[model samples]
Every structure is written in structure tokens, then in C-alpha cells.
Target: MAHTVTDRKKLLNRVKRIKGQSIALENTLENEPDCMAVLQQVAAIKGAVNGLMKEVLEGHLREHLGAEDLSKDQRLEEVEQVISILKSYLK
Candidate 1:
């Protein structure tokens, strides 16, 4: 699927933010920060990553899957694919 330059920029920004969070986490560990503080940072990074995934998934569903006309089996396949992705992410 084609994406506009703006869309690419947005994704790049999200990636940069995630990268920063990861570096912060590393620094926290190296500095021997409080355990709770490190855990909180880890949780925040996980939440951010999940949010990014959700955005990408929603865009794919709307712009690609939703644009297609398919048989019941095909639609079911798409749903299954999405479910599998969700399961993997949750794991």
C-alpha cells in the first residue's frame, strides 16, 4: 500500500520516540536507578510500542482490508490474520 509523505513522517517520529525511550531505559539500568523506576520506564516503553502497533493496524484495516470486497471465507481469513497478530503482540 502507498503512504503519503506525511504518514511516513508520522511513523518515523513514533519510531524516534520509541528509540529515545529505549535509550532512557538503558541509561536507567546503567545508572542503577531504583527498581520501581526502571520497571515504570519499561512499562511506559511497552505501552508506547503497543500504541504504535495499534495505529499501524488500524491504518492497515481501513486502507487495505476495508477497501477490498471478498467472500465470506476471505473475510474470515482476514479476521483470523488480525487475531493472530493481536495474540502475538499480547504474548
Candidate 2:
């Protein structure tokens, strides 16, 4: 995950936006907003989080799985780890 250090700023910005969106959602709830507005805010937050997950997952795949220096066992371990996380995420 150290590879993420290279894109830490960009990742932090995304996280900041997500936090803002969450606050907006909370405000909408507090104000007794329309259902459609609440749903839209929820969707935006989900999409933002999914985008972040995709970026990190891609980096992990390219840097860890695609490395030529990994042994067979190491490669299998990486694949298994990815699979386990993906399963949890998908659920």
C-alpha cells in the first residue's frame, strides 16, 4: 500500500470530497428533505467511494500482482488477498 504514497494528495482530495458529500447528506436529513434529494446524495457518495476503491485496487493489481520479482507463493498470496477483499466489498 506504500505505492499509494505517490498519489496521497489526490486520494486525500477525493476523501475530502466524500466527507463533504456525507455532511451534505446529513444536512439534507436534518432539514426533512425530499426523498429524491436524499437518494441523489446517497448515490453521489456511493459513486465517489467506488471510484476511490477502484483507483486503489488498480494500483494494488499493477504494483503487487504484476511485479516480475514475486515468487509463485507470493503471487498466489496477493491474488488470494485481492479475491478476499473483493468478495467482502461486493457483498
Summarize candidate 2's per-residue lDDT along 38-65 as a digit string, tens digits: 9999999999999999999999999999
Worst 10 residues of 1 by lDDT: 1-10
- Measured by lDDT, the strongest candidate is 2
Best by TM-score: 2
Task: Tell me the TM-score of model 2.
Answer: 0.97
Per-residue C-alpha lDDT of model 1 across residues 6-90, encoded as one tens digit per residue: 4788878888889999999999999969999899989989988987897788887876568667777887888899899999988
Question: How many pairs of residues collide in each model?
Answer: 0, 0
Each model's lDDT comes to 0.83, 0.96
Q: How accurate is candidate 1 locally (lDDT)?
A: 0.83
